[model samples]
Target: MSDIPPLRPLLIERPEDEGAETPATVPPVPDLDIAVPPPRLSRARNSALTRFAMWVFGALFSFVLSVAAWDFVTSLLARDSLLGWIAMVLVGLAIVTAVALAAREMAGFARMGRIDSLRTNAIEAALKADVKAARGVVSGLGALYSARPELAEAQVRLTARGAEMFDADGILGLAEQELLGPLDQAARREVEAAARQVATVTALVPLALADVATALYSNLRMIRRIAAIYGGRSGTLGSLRLMRGVFAHLAATGALAVGDDMIHSVAGGSVLSRISRRFGEGVVNGALTARVGVAAIDVCRPLPFRTLPRPKTSNLVSRALAGLFADADRNEKVK
Candidate 1:
């Protein structure tokens, strides 16, 4: 302490500090230029009031439109009898078409319900091992497929061999083999096709929200077609229900995610991962679509996948994107 110098306060200052004056307002913060985040699933909630409001509005609008149309037709008729008759006829035709469309939609829902009933019956038969119930289920299955001209031969084969079975397992197993085999292939093809389309569109299209729209449309069509293949033949609303059910199951089971399966499925293991960001995202979207397809199959198939193995996401994705990479490579070489 004796050898040390005395402490002193020192203020360091720049030469320009005295002349530089502060501005009236603070300077704005600089942007870091970080990348924008990927879009997430919508989490908007619809309250009961919101739903009721929509229903009320729709009803009022529909009533107003109908009244206006009726008034227009009646006024036209009052002015000119021939023109009025023509207008009336046109309105009658429109009403008939509307009725027919509603009937068709109802029938579609009925068909979807029928598939569900068959699935339930199948589960009961399997659980109880009831031969009688199994036979009934098989009969219903045959009847269901009889309308499809493509399955006529398979139905015949099912009918011919279905009588000899004694045990419940054998009867349903035979039905699974004969009747549902072709349908399974048909459904798998649909899944692969949809996955391929989704991946292709996502990889190539650079527009905003393009992948989202493609995935939604592709998954919807895929579900509807898969339902049709299983004799559901769902209409727009039925298709939406099927889509919802499939996604619900996925959510409940925590299957709504990507995994190592994606790496293995798209373009020869990990090779495609390094190719392009768009291609990688495309693979993920496609893989998810394939998952939805599998779930749709489970929802729509009359009998559960007992004899036939359920499709794996990786296997479906591999087959789907195999040709995609080949075409991409060709394009690169050509360019």
Candidate 2:
């Protein structure tokens, strides 16, 4: 009894219901900053330098002519009459040869310039037509889809016409033919591949409608930036028109989730108003315009503009738009 009493005196205990939890500590997150290089100015400078060099060469020839003229006058005055006459004839002959050589070299260049101009015009025209056609198809499909959203069968059926219109081969038929068809094998393949992709992407009109709409917006913004850097020129009107046509088509199609009223409002704006925006910077800014201009000089140039390098870029939206009518005249493919 004495041993048990001694242990009982130490009993002091709390109530049973205490709840406690240790909180978890979180690690801090680090912010990452990535750096991208500035866009390439080399390509632009190269193009400008090349044109400047052509002008310089032309200027040098003029200088040579001036020197010859001065020499001819002095020789005539001194009149070792035979020597003067002989030197005069030789100078005339030399001038003629130089001119002939320059003309021969410049002919190809002139043709290239014209091709650039005409091809650009053709691209603008084709885009306008495609946009118009696309709008009609989109409007028709949108109306059908809106009224009968439940009818999946009807939706697919309605989209088929627009999709066909977007077909790559159908689009190719709109390009300048003679220039594109005779391209070397590798170049031809690249163009064909691009054409195929455009056609396939286009055939999914509803999806393309959204893509086109988004891309058009992005492209317009980007083009303006390029134009600011590149500055405006005559051919730039065509490029701006190309963008306008795409945006107009997308607006007309009612592709975005925006209300019908907004779509109609946008489409109501004058097409010309949209087209009058700025164009690109750099040396080859109107290069396509030059090429197309030359192509048009030929009567057999065909309906669609053709022959030219397809411009590729890290900027995908502008690149796609640029490529939209790229193969119109096949002749411009890089060899």
Candidate 3:
């Protein structure tokens, strides 16, 4: 090996040399920018520790409340048996109600899980071209929506023609066209409504952080409704899970931020940006909401977009903001 050279500073230090200048840091900017973020649930740096603390503290607090209740009931009993008995019964009922609510939450989670498994099974069957498994998936889908009067005709049609299809793709595709067609339309409507709401609020609301709160509320409600539309019937916790899943997918795919594609699609040529900056921010926010809604549909829908076409974020945003765009154009022309 040849002689090795040691690393050295670019300039030699000298006692008499003037003090070197420190590198300047970039100035901090506000998060509420014209190109906005659809609000995300923030996490602590030590997320695991935070979760542990939450559960431990929750359990201790609950236990303390329970002990206090029991003591109060016992003291009342010692004072007067009738009032104590009534209070005891009321407390017991409350406990039972809480247990029932908890059970309902668990059931909601299980329902969402069932839909997920159903989707997974459908994908597998479709890929393998397994007629039998596809039929099973169809049967499950039918059963899931059997209670709905609106699906009665679709259900009957599916059951009658399902036996005729010999391949998985055909079976699932037909099921898609029949069973999920109307449901898809309803879900699309929900997404549009959410996108419109988000865009309108973001553009008009001048208060700091107001847009963030509105976006969160609208997205959460939209997601929950979409889940219900797809037969997920998600409860509070289930809805939160769906929200996390939707946003996480967006983040993982790096689709969380607005891009050139979204900008062109939303405005048809950056027209919104020229019309009004705040309105432009609103438009971007609305587009992001549409993206989130589409992702929610993907997560909540039992079947993948193998047969049916998935909703495009562009198309949805364009239609959602058509009225707003027209209004903005009219105002621009008036000026």
Q: Number of the top candidate by TM-score?
A: 3
Residue 47 displacement in candidate 2 (angstroms) = 17
**Would you give me the overall lDDT of model 2?**
0.36
Query: What tens-digit string does per-residue lDDT give for candidate 3 at 62-83?
Result: 9999999999999999999998
TM-score of 3: 0.79
User: Which residue runs does candidate 1 get wrong by more than 4 Å?
Assistant: 1-67, 268-270, 326-335
TM-score of 2: 0.27
Q: Residues 115-233, candidate 2, lDDT per residue (tens digit)?
A: 33433344454566655543443343244234432445444543454356564334434222212333222232332333234332432334525534533343444333332221111
Model 2: per-residue Cα lDDT at residue 56: 100
Cα deviation in Å at residue 314, candidate 2? 18
**Model 2 CA lDDT for position 24:** 48
What are the lDDT figures for the candidates, one per model? 0.79, 0.36, 0.81
Model 3 stretches astray by more than 4 angstroms:
1-65, 80-83, 268-270
TM-score for all models, in order of appearance = 0.77, 0.27, 0.79
The candidate with the higher lDDT, 2 or 3, is 3
**Candidate 2: deviation at residue 67, Å?**
5.4
Model 1 C-alpha lDDT per residue in residues 188-268, reported as the tens digit of each score: 999999999999899999999988999999999998898889888866666666777777766655556776545554665
Candidate 2: regions farther than 4 A off: 1-69, 72-79, 130-171, 174-179, 184-335
